[model samples]
Target: MIRAAKCSFCGGDVEPGTGIMFVKRDGTVLHFCSSKCRRSMLELKRKPVKVKWARKTREQAEAKVRRR
Candidate 1:
């Protein structure tokens, strides 16, 4: 079953079979919708919340849902 992936850095939808999947030495799996997302995450080491252009992360969205 193909499932849509969420961008690890931008919280954007990554269509099945598209985007980049990065695996860290510690077994951390990160999905990036675009090279821009990948660069922001690994190279730049920027936080989604701290970046004004970044979208709200899945955790942030879930937190809002749980709070209500």
Candidate 2:
């Protein structure tokens, strides 16, 4: 069984042959589920933790401690 790759920018599921893949100069591979994610990460330089639709944003928020 082939495993689906998750989008590097949004943490969304990317089915095989359906998304874009980028190889950086450092040899790190980045996968994106759509043009929005690709542009946000590569062109706009937006952080995943700051994107509302990104799963990492929620995860990062949950990881923080709430001090009263």
Candidate 3:
């Protein structure tokens, strides 16, 4: 049975139209409808994301101490 695929980037239904598949080390797979989306997805994986709690500054730490 042939199942329809979906695009990870734009959430569009993929119709076997020359798409690219990405596989991670943990066996996770992501499919993209075009090369453009695939390239962008790879770039996103290369960048590091900062945690919200880790973004606190020195002043914020001092204020928390004063409140306590």
TM-score of each: 0.79, 0.81, 0.55
Task: Write candidate 2's Cα lDDT for 1-68 as tens digits.
Answer: 76799999988899987999999999999999999999999999999987898988887777774431
Better candidate by lDDT, 1 or 2: 2
**Which pairs, if any, clash in model 3?**
none
Which regions of candidate 3 deviate over 4 angstroms?
44-68
Query: What TM-score does candidate 1 reach?
Result: 0.79
In candidate 3, how many Å is residue 2 off? Answer: 2.1
RMSD value for candidate 3:
11.1
Q: Note the clash tally of each candidate.
A: 0, 0, 0
Whose lDDT is greatest here? 2
Span of ten consecutive residues with least summed lDDT in model 3: 46-55
Summarize candidate 3's per-residue lDDT along 1-68 as a digit string, tens digits.
Answer: 65667765554566765577788899988877776556655775421122222212344556889999
RMSD of each: 3.2, 2.3, 11.1
Question: Candidate 3 has what TM-score?
Answer: 0.55
**lDDT ranking of the models:** 2, 1, 3
